[model samples]
Target: MITLQDLRKVYATRSGEVVALDGISLEIPQGQIHGIVGQSGAGKSTLIRCLTALERPTTGSVVVDGAEVSVLSETQLRRARRRIGMVFQHVNLFEARTAAANIAYPLAVAGVPRAERATRVAELLDLVGLGGRGDAYPAQLSGGQKQRVGIARALATEPAVLLCDEPTSALDSATTRQILRLIRDVRDRLGITVVIITHETSVVREVCDAATLLADGRIVESGPLADVVTRPGSKLSQALVPVPDVGVADQRTLVQVSAGGAQAQIAHALYAIATEPDAHVVAGAIETLGGVRVGRWHLDVPDGDRAAVLGRLRAAGLAVEEDVA
Candidate 1:
């Protein structure tokens, strides 16, 4: 539902022209929840702005729902933007407006009838699990409640694509999970495409069907969760499925092995390691992502046995990374 072709954005600064995006080309299919993750200054925000036509790219095209967003006329963009809904990290609801009224604001702006707006607002309120809280003001609601209101408001217009910018960054872990589940629920119900921009790896792991890692305005890695996680020595793999730190003898060589897919594959990997007398498992983590069970293990082995252990792990269908730091 979204396509970015050779996208590039440059900024004029006092020092010089700063390149915020560098040749970023990506495609997100309809009804998919895609996550864009990176540290600050990685152009994540710039990329989202480009998608919304808020920040025009210096070069290349931005297409959403078949609209060439980057080149749209101002009037055209205003109309085209109706197909894109935005959810901010901060709820940004009007303080004086009740939750229901906040949700009605978008419809109001779009010239929706008051009676129709009321009905839509009510449905959105229930959709985000804020059924009766419609009457409450922002001040009276909890952080999670406010975000729900934000989500409801974003969905008020039933946009074809939902753009979430750090949607769960301000919430606690438990609340974050709740919001993530709500997003997934929204996707399942509406079948709209979702693009979540976040710095948190946990958010991507918990909610994204596919994820892209950005570094210095370039894509470091991008793919479905399963492909990225199971890739041999993948940077995304290391970040998403990190093995815990364990104190061990420095004289031993550390080898990291990861496997994703069937339960039997993980079991086989474990058995292979267990059967090796010289391989001592120091740390490990297992997680289910994209409906696949994936596991990563850090093993300490005698330097002389490193080759043999890696050979065995590879033979058992495990992706192995030797001499992991």
Candidate 2:
């Protein structure tokens, strides 16, 4: 239940004013896992900060659960922030504190009683799959473990919204999946809205229900993950799932087959047949985009009259198109 309207954030730098966020407007539904994806300096970090009120916007309003966050007083914002929890890239866990204490720190600051804090910390430890590691310190834990602790701490207050800023950017692929699964679990169990900010689309594909693409502090595209990823020849599609960049040969026809699920399996079989004398596959990149198996197969045919072959692929319920590059 978060909505941003014409959001803009500007900073007074030595060279006039710099706009970190340029008219970013988004609505994240409650109990859904949403992703804001872009490269660094794309206003992803600034957007999240706006949500947590760590950095107020220069113009526009941020409404969370019907509360206009931008208009809140400092004291009101602090109280409102309790209902929103954030997880950072580096996880910033206190080295001196044990995992249990680290998770309990927030509650401790909020004046939670010792007995209550202990119970909450224990429950969170188990929730993050660190039940037996509460006694360990940050130095004694792996990168994933530290993040687990960070998550436990974030959920310590049972916030209605969870904002994860590059939550698994530092972890390995396997660990990243584990963390994503954990975030999903957190959303499912708590029924809380989850917003993830990442530079890579893989994270969104693995976990996000909806997504928005940001470039140069502006939202270039916003829609269902599947729609954005599957739109042929769109900037969003090319950026999210890269196709071959090389130009096609005049003697040979360039064909790209983009499909998902069962169609992808059939595409593999058809590509096997494309290895025949009439046509041959140049290069292919098969990948999962928006949680669906999709690929771009660059096929080269000797004759330009591949209309029959292309028609056959399309007749089989696959997406086939002639590629320009």
Candidate 3:
């Protein structure tokens, strides 16, 4: 539903030119929840703004729903923007407006009729699980509730694409989970494409079908969420799912193992060898990803037996690495 080709955005400062986005090329399929993640100053927010035409790029192109947003006229862009909805980090709702009124605001802006706006507002409130809270004002609602109102308002236009910028950053863990679930529910129900921009890896883990990692205004990695999360090469993946502690004791070998129905066998063999008093199982962790097993273990043994022990481990149908003397 969205395609970016050689999308470059540069800025001029007192010092020199700054490339906020350096030729970022990406494709977001329809009906998928895609995540863009990075630390502060990663150009993630800049990229999102460019996608919605809130910020014009210095070069390249942004194609959304088949229209080249970069070339659209001011009037054309305004009309095109109506097909895209955005939920901001701060839940930018009208403070004085009630929940229902806040939701109706977008429809009103779109020139939706009064009766249709009222009906749409009611439907959106129900869709976002704020059914009767429509009478409450933003100040009267909780953080999560305010966000629900914001989501409802964004959906008021029934856009084909939704852009969420740190939607759960302000909430607690439980509330964050609730909001993520709600977003997923809405995506599934409406079949709308979603682009979530955030610095939180946990948010991506919980909600994203695919993810891209950005650094210093450039994309470093991007792929399926499961593969990217489980792969060892990604720093973002490491932060999201940390490996267990494997202390390297004296005379021990630290072996990085894969979790693939072989953990029990490896453990048993290690235990049998460690029966020699000077040997013992130190630490390990078994993690499953994409229905495959992968993990690491540390095993202590007499220095004299190291070679034999490693040989036995390999012979036992396990991939092992000798780490210690």
RMSD after CA superposition, every candidate: 1.3, 3.3, 4.3
Best by TM-score: 1
Q: Which has the greatest lDDT?
A: 1
The 10 consecutive residues of candidate 2 with the worst lDDT sum are 269-278
* Best first by TM-score, ranked: 1, 2, 3
Q: Give one digit per residue, the lDDT tens place, for model 1 in 1-325.
A: 9999999999999999999999999999999999999899999999999999999999999999999998899999988888999999997999999999999998998999999998899899999999999999999999999999999898888899999999999999999999999999999999999999999989999999999999999999999998888777788877887788877686788878888888998898888888888888889999988787889998888887778777877888888887677
lDDT of 3 by residue, 1-325 (tens): 9999999999999999999999899999999899899998999999999989999999999998889999999999988888898999999999989999999988888899999998889899999898988999899999999999998888888888999999999999999999999999999999999999998977887888888888888889887655764454455555545455656655455544222334575365545444535446566555443333445445665677767766765565555545422
> Each prediction's Cα lDDT score?
0.91, 0.84, 0.80
Deviation in Å, model 1, residue 285 alpha carbon = 0.8
Window of ten residues with lowest summed lDDT in model 3: 254-263
Flag regions of model 3 displaced more than 4 Å.
230-232, 244-325
